[model samples]
Target: MQHEAKAARTVKEDRTDYLTEERYGHTAAHATMALTGTEWGVTTWNTRPRSVGRVTVCASNGPFAFQESISPVEARLIAQALLMAADDAEKAIDAAYVQDEVTA
Candidate 1:
């Protein structure tokens, strides 16, 4: 039916377009957590406009990163990505460290 097609199109468009307030919340959570160095599990919300949202990057040590008096969005992005990259990039720095630790 035409309605089904429209609904499908809507879903696709939401991916790129600016997400709604709800989408922002999830994005913020995902970004913050990723920055905190939880895991590499990244998710996409608001599938209409195709928003990549944010990437959560943790530190190499995996203790989570903390920042103070932050201004500008770029700073936030860098902070988050750097933290995640540090964590994600840790495999190269300490393969044994990762191997030694086991997750449930």
Candidate 2:
């Protein structure tokens, strides 16, 4: 097995920030993440055989992390689940904000 370091770059504009990294070769891999306020968007590429991907979600008080290596089909399922979960969470937060405004 051989080890290689990926190249990474960061960009910031106004209140938004972005970071991108790439390992550009036969086993090409890439990752990019962006942040604006409390929201984030992430994308990744895993071309190496039997590669594992990890995701960590955190809050001001603590962090939660998950990692796994699965078949390409399973990867799509997991990604869809995560997106739906995020959407549900955002809706819950919006509802809370509305309630707070009504009570205040």
Candidate 3:
């Protein structure tokens, strides 16, 4: 039997799907809470033959920050909900503006 030296190679690889400032999320106002204007970074990666895609959301600038690890499907659902909420908020704003103009 003979032994030979071999170069080291990475066995695991992580493919990042999102890592841009534009992909970051922001804090939104709620019924009883005010918006703190906190920017949240959304990162996602996929590992081969290990697990499904992961989505992480963390605050960029704030004393109170959080990190949540979720699946890609859950992330998509959250994105959809955000879009729907945003659309509703926009419509409400437009309606308020129209009412103000009528009163003025």
Candidate 4:
């Protein structure tokens, strides 16, 4: 189940997914980090012909790939970023507390 859902969501399959260049190998590729907290998935691709001897580029190609295994370095970076965000959140909570005290 972990790999299944990650595979499904990692590839950003928009409406024109099939027609995208990444499908036909035309665009540079990249991946967005796992949103659902799991970075495991695959990207698929395909090619098609619109007219004889004519090639149309598909922007939708790519990210048909996912990070199957999270490295220790990446995991640590992620953890650090998360901790920073949490610290900011704690600061926000403290600010709210100060606001409440002022109001009282």
Indicate which candidate wins on TM-score. 3
> Considering summed lDDT, which 10 consecutive residues are worst modelled in model 2?
11-20
Clash count, one per candidate? 19, 0, 0, 10
Cα displacement (Å) at residue 82, model 2: 0.4
What is the lDDT, from 0 to 100, of the residue 99 in candidate 1?
Answer: 62
Measured with C-alpha atoms, the lDDT of residue 25 in candidate 1 is: 26
Clash pairs, model 2 backbone? none
Clashing pairs in 4: 20-58, 20-60, 20-61, 21-58, 21-59, 22-61, 23-61, 42-64, 43-64, 43-65
Quantify all predictions' global Cα lDDT against the true fold: 0.36, 0.43, 0.55, 0.39
Question: Candidate 4, which segments miss by more than 4 Å at Cα?
Answer: 1-68
Candidate 2 deviates by what RMSD? 12.5
**Residue 53 in candidate 1 has what lDDT?**
51
Q: TM-scores for all candidates? A: 0.23, 0.41, 0.61, 0.35
lDDT measured at residue 44 in model 2 versus the true structure, 0 to 100:
33
Of the candidates shown, which would achieve the greatest lDDT relative to the real structure?
A: 3
- Sort the candidates on TM-score, descending order: 3, 2, 4, 1
What RMSD, rounded to one decimal, does every model reach?
13.2, 12.5, 15.5, 14.7
Model 4 agreement with the true structure over 23-78: per-residue lDDT tens digits: 23333133224453322222232232323222222222245332333344654676
Q: Taking the tens digit of each residue's C-alpha lDDT, what string does model 3 give over 1-104? A: 12122222222256442323211243221111126555545555556544446766665445776778788789899999999999999999999999999999
Model 1 vs. true fold: TM: 0.23
- Estimate the lDDT of model 2: 0.43
- Lowest lDDT sum, 10 consecutive residues, model 1, at 1-10
lDDT of 1 by residue, 1-104 (tens): 11110111112333321111123223321221224433222223353233345322222326654323223375467659989999977867687667667541
